[model samples]
Target: MVLHDLRKYSFWGLLSLAINLMYTKIIFPCALLVRRPAHIRILGSYSIGRGFTSGPGLILDVLNDNAELLIGSNVKLNHRCHIGVMKSVKIGNDVLFASNVFISDHTHGSYIGDMQSNPLQPPNEREIVCGNVEIGDKVWIGENVAVLLGVSIGESSIIGANSVVTKDIPAFSIAVGSPARVIKTWDKAVEKWVAVS
Candidate 1:
């Protein structure tokens, strides 16, 4: 399974390496209007669906493979954000993404099939297998952050901007740092979520 996925993402990542951002100005607005979403605003050249558009610097790559990158209503992806979906990535309602955020369901590179020219060979592929990336309701993903594969961020969690989440985060927690540890817990009564001591 891992080998299969490794080949899947690596192949597509190279295949769909489009750097041109010119299509957004013309192709995006019409796609959204045709789809008729509540809101849409695209600034960069992202291969997007009809329902994607909000804020500037939002860059989407390889949109055709993302049959699973589902965005909820009132959710906004800010500028310079990258969303990569290989398997399934579901976002709940009212979520916000600051600048330079990245979310994906699968690893970017994997080797799942035989690299040699053979019709039938053992799949010599190493892959980072993950279930999915599910963002719960009212979540806030900060800038320059990477949400890795098989990572489930709980509902109402505030991921510190520019952090990398490689594991599952529980609900109502504030996670930060490279591996994104639970730095603090959200205290509804304190009028502010306190960091985990």
Candidate 2:
């Protein structure tokens, strides 16, 4: 009875190890290829650090040759996170992102011209406004969050769900709402987060 039980446990352990090997060696690489097909004209130049794990449906769109996307170590990105890099995107270590997070450093339509002048033109043909996005370490961005062009999110900052980050968020701040504003900031003197007026 003891030998039988030991064999059963060993079989299950071996099966688990085989599955992990398949996932790391074959499944993950195939998933990346399927998610980003060769026909897509996205040129990606990524400098990723160790311990980076991304869930399914990760899309990396690099619009230009000079575009760069740098992700630091120990970062976790949830499913369907789209990173559109037109200039540069620098993400620091230990950052966690929830599902459907979109970080882009460019805007698709031309803001200078009149809306009705070339309204029928395709969006892809329109001019792109490019900038750089910098996200510091230990930042947490919630689901459906969109970090727009030229925004910098500082270290230890928490961006609430569905927030549209349009500007710079200071370090140790808690920001929420559309066009996210800092609702709370860490006060070192008080050793706690204080409300921002």
Candidate 3:
């Protein structure tokens, strides 16, 4: 009875290991929206590096052939994170994104006129305004953050929760608020982060 139990345990362990390997190697590479190792949905194109991990409900949408979404190694994207790339979006290595973060490099229609006037025309049919978004290495983006078009986030920066990033964030800085102001920056001389006076 002891020997039979040992064999059963070993067989189950091997089966689990095989499933994990298949999910990581075969399924993840082919799937567009990956909910888990086994569950995935087709959506967009991704140029991802090694050791990329994402939680449930990640949306990656590449609009056209010119659109490119490049994610570097060891990046972790938490639940319900949406990344829409109409032009280009380059994310560097070791980046951590919390839940409900939205990053988009394009906007629907030109900022010329109000859309309420034309009720018949669908918004999706309008022209898209696109730009490139570049995020450097070791950046941590908190929950409910929205990163807009043409923004460049420098290395080792921290984006606070519920912030809207409309402009560039400098390296080693902590930014917060609606426009995402730089509230603090890492002072290399002091070996710590200092508040902006």
Clashes of each: 10, 0, 0
Across residues 47-153, which tens digit of lDDT does each residue of candidate 1 receive?
A: 33344445555544433333455666666676667776546778887788887788877653443465423335434443334357899988999878999888999
Q: Which stretches of model 1 miss by more than 4 angstroms?
A: 1-52, 61-67, 108-130, 189-192
Model 3 TM-score, all chains together? 0.79
TM-score ranking of the models: 3, 2, 1
Instruction: Report the alpha-carbon TM-score of model 1 versus the true structure.
Output: 0.61
TM-score of each: 0.61, 0.77, 0.79
Minimum summed lDDT over a 10-residue window in model 3 is located at 30-39
Off by over 4 Å in 3: 1-21, 29-34, 37-45, 112-121
| Model 2 collision count | 0
- lDDT of candidate 2 over 52-132, digit per residue (tens): 666667777777788888888878888888898989999999999998999999987756556532568788787778779
Q: What's the distance in Å from true for residue 50, model 1? A: 11
Could you tell me which residue pairs clash in candidate 2?
none
- Model 2 has an lDDT value of 0.80
> lDDT per residue, candidate 3, 1-197, as tens digits?
14564476577665764465456677556322234422332244667887787776777777777788889988889898888888889999999999999999988766645642244567788767887999999999999999999999999999999999999999999999999999999999989999999
Error of 1 at 110 (Å): 6.7
